[model samples]
Target chain A: MIILIDKKGFVLSLDAAVAVVLVTIILMGSAFFFLKTNETFIVNMQMLRVGSDITAVLQADGTLDTLDPLQIKSGIEEILPISYNMRMLINSTASSSIIIVETESAQTNKKFIVAGKRFFYAVQGGNAYPSAVTYEVWPK
Target chain B: MKKAVFFTLSLTMFAFIVLSLSFIFAGNAATDDARFMELASINRIYDLDTSLQNSFSKIFSLDSEMTYTASTTEAIFQQKIPFNFTRLNNSFNNLRNFAIYNDKNVQVGLLPNNVSLRVSQAGIVNWQNISKNITEFMRTNSTPKSYSFIIDFFEINITSCSSSSASGNFSFSVAATGGNGTSCNQTLSINPLQDASVEISLGTKSLTVLFSNYSASVNARDNKVALTSRINYADTGVKPKIFLESKINITVPGLIAKKYGDLRIA
Candidate 1:
């Protein structure tokens, strides 16, 4: 018969082990969040760039005096491959606007108009911050 | 064994959390991008519209002033001359589109296409080939005391590409009456002149009117009187008015009593 010693009175030092486990979990969580945020930022940046480029192209085309629709489309296509969803609306006064993804796609909607010499904002989405870049079409 | 189990569970949770966060961030980024794109597109359209409106306004203003000057000149000519002088000068540098029609609804001369008003008339002489017919009439006429003339003017059309192109016609008609009318058994030389009323229907938004009146005595002993009127309409549907008056004394000696008068409106 062996006499049982009260080794239960001896406290186990779990500091190193617990510290490692905690560090691992924290590292994993942080990495996951960082990667996600980075990806989102990149995608947003790309989309913004594309949209701005398209706007610039349309303005540069000036008024749609040329009866050649293909010319205009080709000109825009040179800069960005327009999806089937992309559409352009021209007004009787020789102004135009392009509408892209639907509200369902991004949970947001926007509209703009050309007033006098400056670009005026008509609408903004819930998630969008105001832009600082103001655009204008010079007199012909 | 328990420790191993707990560690394994923690690892799985961490992996799941990371995966979910990544998805959320990605989705957010995509959403933001779309918003930015839409806003930019709108701004472009707005800018274009503003520019077009401003240009149109300036052009319209200049056109109104030019029309006034042309009418005033025509009125003065009719008063001084015995013959009916229909002023057909409607072409202006700022007008993109213009048209002219007579009281009988007949289109006389179209500018920038059928005729170039810029060089059509050299003083009182017709320079363009199209006006050769009118010039011949003026040369052959010895007695201008009994005659009628109609003049029409219009502006050129400008394109969206900022190129000047041909467009719809805007016209004004001037009718001058000069003849011998018997009143109370007395033969009186009467020269009745009518100024063409200028009407411009640019679109549903704007309308412009120009009118003038002038009268003179055939005896060349009386004073000549002329009146010019201009009106411009804007968004409030109210019309703005401008009027000018001029008087001239004639000293040409003639025994025959001759009277001249004219009225015009569109």
Candidate 2:
């Protein structure tokens, strides 16, 4: 038996190769779409938006300057919605760890977190202190 | 061969359509991310603005306005407060401690080079050229937005005999021993931002004309406040709504935002 090679089959081979590549890409794209759709995208985005708004309101009223855990906790509680829970971690030059303020549910059991970090300066004793405040929000 | 070629072309076209659809959806996602980031960036910028402003006031207030305890003394600025581009930038940078912020590959960070202060009051052309003695100290302040000035609004050098009473945002009675005593009640409008004067002569007897907060306060007491005491004139430098605006640009991987917001550092 002699092996036969046909030059005319070249285009057919090229098409098969191209088709294989296309099919793989389509599969990968479909997988990505399905995976993405399964996740809580809107909730996470809402969390981010909520976090941003919360920080803005806190910074606006000069409440961030106090650096008091209790005060910050109250401020967050006032701004955040009833359904969401938030925890803030503040780091300033004046103290190694100034305060970490959070709601009860924010620290509890399960976790789906969206975090935003903001840089601000707080006035402490006639001097301004630069601070990095991070807010993490999760749905209750 | 023809059928194979047609099939390949058809598959390529289908792939292109899928990719285009993906891009359209991806574009919307990018927009959402930008919106959220922008909102956050603006809030943070606002905080930074107030912080810088409050810091400026604190520094100056420590020097003059707030108390006289440590006048001309602060870690921020030495000798005189810097108003130039370079010095002010240096001063503000010295005030903050952003460990590794605005560094390479930072997804969200302020571009340090892009942060700049506009010290010259907007309306006053070439304010940078003005000296500290005249611009900063002598006159309280006059800006495009608002002004409260402590300027010598009137210079009355009475050379001859004259009895005169003045009105309009201010009032003065010069009991002249000898002025151009034509019994002239001059109704003059005062615009201190510009060089303004009413020369009334008190006959070689030197009279000290003092302008206190009264000029500004009276002008403020009435909106478009005119003395209108048989005289109608309004010259109020807008009560000096002082604010220091800085242009700062923040950047993410794909977005660049230039903020010309008022830092309110005054």
Candidate 3:
């Protein structure tokens, strides 16, 4: 018995293999890049969510009624991500005042920051008062 | 034939890697979505709790106005306390909807499996009219992870009137148990006998007028109370009405670990 190989067919097969390898490499690179970029998006959204949640909790517990800004600021700091920096401000319509509840810096971890704001009603002196609280967050 | 077989194997390996990465990315997305829903649900509960506190404050403030009618010496001074029932109902609905939305997944459970509203009043008067039924949501302990809310409403009433004009004294007081710890009280004393009308101010915009005939003895008072004189006062709990103290307590499954990403597993 004897076997014969076609040179043209062998060359075509080699080219096809090379193309497949190139396509795989491109696919792998793009997928890795996409995942890396999404991490930033996720972190920003998480920070904003944290701010809105803390503000809503403080308002609901009647802590806002005390007219002391520090109470809510401290609460936000407690629930927030440890690596993130935060600042809170309360704007009151009744008193026409803007109060800085609390502020902190994450120091070296301050890159890629985001902020969130929320509005809610607070009862003071037997009347409903509307207030706006803003939260600024950054990874530490 | 050998080259063909090698090419087929390479393509299969590449496809598998891509598919696995896709699945991992999808899982992460689902976790983020679940976390958002959880945060939203928590915010709603907080708002509802605050609304409950405000309503109680308004109701208590209106109680002061009840004192205005006492000036006539009526056997029964009845005044209905006005509260925003619609707002209360709306808050309750929001709370229920968010709770369901936040914990719909099988992975999430209502730790205690029940919600309750408990009312503790100072008196035994039938308060069904002023009270909202809470037994409907009450439940016992259960396993599958759950959440429950306990609302406390406290009421204290004080009423006193004297028929004698010989320097009599009347006092009334009501207190709030928690959350700021504030108490309110009123005291009035009439000097030696005189055929004069006495005015007593108990709260913000609350005043009760007492008419006395200096010569009439304490035993000559009649059971009938004349509504001839009406004094309008701001509704703040003063004379004899329901005084409410409310607090919200929540019990739900929680983790000692402080990672937002862990909510997916929770």
Candidate No. with top lDDT: 2
Off by over 4 Å in 3: A1-10, A37-42, A105-117, A123-128, B1-266
- For every candidate, the chain B TM-score is 0.25, 0.34, 0.23
Q: What TM-score does chain B of candidate 3 reach?
A: 0.23
User: Higher-TM-score candidate among 2 and 3?
Assistant: 2
Cα lDDT listed for each candidate: 0.28, 0.46, 0.39
| Native contact fraction, candidates in order | 0.08, 0.06, 0.03
**Candidate 2, superposed: residue stretches over 4 Å from native:** A1-41, A104-112, A124-128, B1-94, B97-131, B136-245, B253-262
Between candidates 1 and 2, the one scoring higher on TM-score is: 2
Error of 3 at B173 (Å): 29
- Give lDDT tens digits, candidate 3, residues A18-99: 6666656665666665576567557666776666666666766767656675676676666767876677766655566677
Candidate 1 chain B weakest ten by summed lDDT: B98-107
B201-221: candidate 1 lDDT, tens digit per residue: 222311212222221111111
Q: Assess every candidate by TM-score.
A: 0.25, 0.46, 0.38
Best by TM-score: 2
Judged by DockQ cut-offs, is candidate 2 incorrect, acceptable, medium or high? incorrect
